[model samples]
Target: MTPFQTLTGTAAPLLEKGKLMSNVDTDMIIPKQFLKTTTRTGLSKGLFHELKTRADGSENPDFVLNKPAYAKAGILIAGENFGCGSSREHAPWALLDQGITCVIAPSFADIFHNNCYKNGILPVRLPMDVCEQLAALAGGANHVFTVDLATQTLTTPDGVTHAFDVDPGRKSNLMAGLDEIGASLKVAGEISEFEHKRRLMTPWLEPAI
Candidate 1:
């Protein structure tokens, strides 16, 4: 995980106007066929595979992601209840692999939200109306947006600002590029000291050398 301080890039609307595609599960984000790989490589090709393809595996130009302007979009302004299904870390992995560093939505699945932070993706949660406005703005010209995690704010290309909040511990971990294990290891000295004291107090619990 790399420390995520700020991301400034093109913001693309994940859906059209008034078409709120809620409850977008991990399976839909990346189908079961794509879950065979344990590695992050090659997952991007499967992103929204079902939605972005036709019955005969043809490219669906109608899909928002298939559009030329959004092809390389790094920030996704999405609807509510996004990522609402199974807890698959691969969802964020695929997004990150596809160069999406941030996701702005009204709501997200709990596990998916946590996975985003672990994988160096910033998941911004804003009010539904705010998200709708951002989505609308993203659809028009001026789609570029900036997300400053340090400031906990989202800045639209037109200078509009929206405040957001994240867990302080998560924020610290993200800034330092530390995952759960990395965070725990940050106090390794204390852990080692405690273990040493425990061994001295309970010598019989120690294995024979």
Candidate 2:
């Protein structure tokens, strides 16, 4: 997994709230062979087109990602209730697996948000107005920007800064690059020491070791 400190791009505004995954889940988003890519750059070429069409070659321009703005989006600043659809890990996996390290929106589906954390993607929540402003910003002439989940700040390429919020615990984990399993492992040595002490204190409590 990649370590993330900041991101800068001139791409699409995030798909807001519940509309995102639902609006774009059309083609299942990926295929087995494309998933085998060894790098992120070429991965975008295989993004959503994998399951979108039949042999006839017609296209679904209605998909959010197909829109000109979202085609190469890096930081997604969207609206509330984002990522609310299917429980497919493939969705978030495909996103991160496609070089998206930062996703900022008003809200995110619980499972989706968790998936972001584990996969090293930063999922942020801002107010609706903020998302709208970001949408406008994203429409400009190749506007560049960055979102830092650790500092809870958004930085435009012009150097403007906007403060945001994140759960304190979540902030710590992201900064340290620790997922749930990684967090638990931090105390393994202590737990082992305690169990050894317990055995010495009460041999009777230990079965026939």
Candidate 3:
């Protein structure tokens, strides 16, 4: 996972018929068909598969992501309860593959919120009104937005800054680019020492190879 400190890029608003769609679940972000792969590579092709694809398997030009201007958006402005439903890590994987690193919404599923941090994605929670304002700004000609994890602030295209809160540990891990595995490796020396002592103290607990 890449370290996240400050990100400056265009924001894509995930809207349906000019209105923000609520309860944007994981299946909507990346359908179950795309969850076959354990690795994160090539998942971008399946990101928002349903929304971006038409009934005849053609591209849905009306979708926000399919729009040329938002094709490479690095941030997403979404509605409440985003990333709901199943707890699939692939959701963030697909988003990251699609070059999206930050998602702003009024709220998010607990599991999905934690998964975002583990994958180096910043999921910001703000008031619904604030998110709507941000989405409107993102749809404008000047759609660039800046998110500073170190400062816990999001700067809109119009120069207004909004503050948000995040867990200290998660914030630290993101800033250091430390995923769960990476974080555990940081204490490898201590783990090895403890294992060595455990073997001597209770050899019977060891499994037979």
Question: Predicted candidate 2: what Cα RMSD to the true structure?
Answer: 4.7
Instruction: Report model 3's TM-score to 2 decimal places.
Output: 0.93
Model 1 lDDT tens row, 1-209: 88999988888777744565667889998888888889987899999898889999899998878898888899988888888889988899999888898998889999999899889998999988898889888888778899999999999988999999999999999999999999999999999999999999999999999
lDDT of each: 0.88, 0.66, 0.95
TM-score (C-alpha) between model 1 and the true structure:
0.94
List ranges where model 1 is wrong by over 4 Å. 204-209
Rank list by lDDT: 3, 1, 2
Q: What is residue 35's positional error in candidate 3, in angstroms?
A: 2.0
* Ranking 1 against 3 by TM-score, winner: 1
| Each candidate: RMSD | 1.6, 4.7, 1.7
Clashing pairs in 3: none
Best candidate (score: lDDT): 3
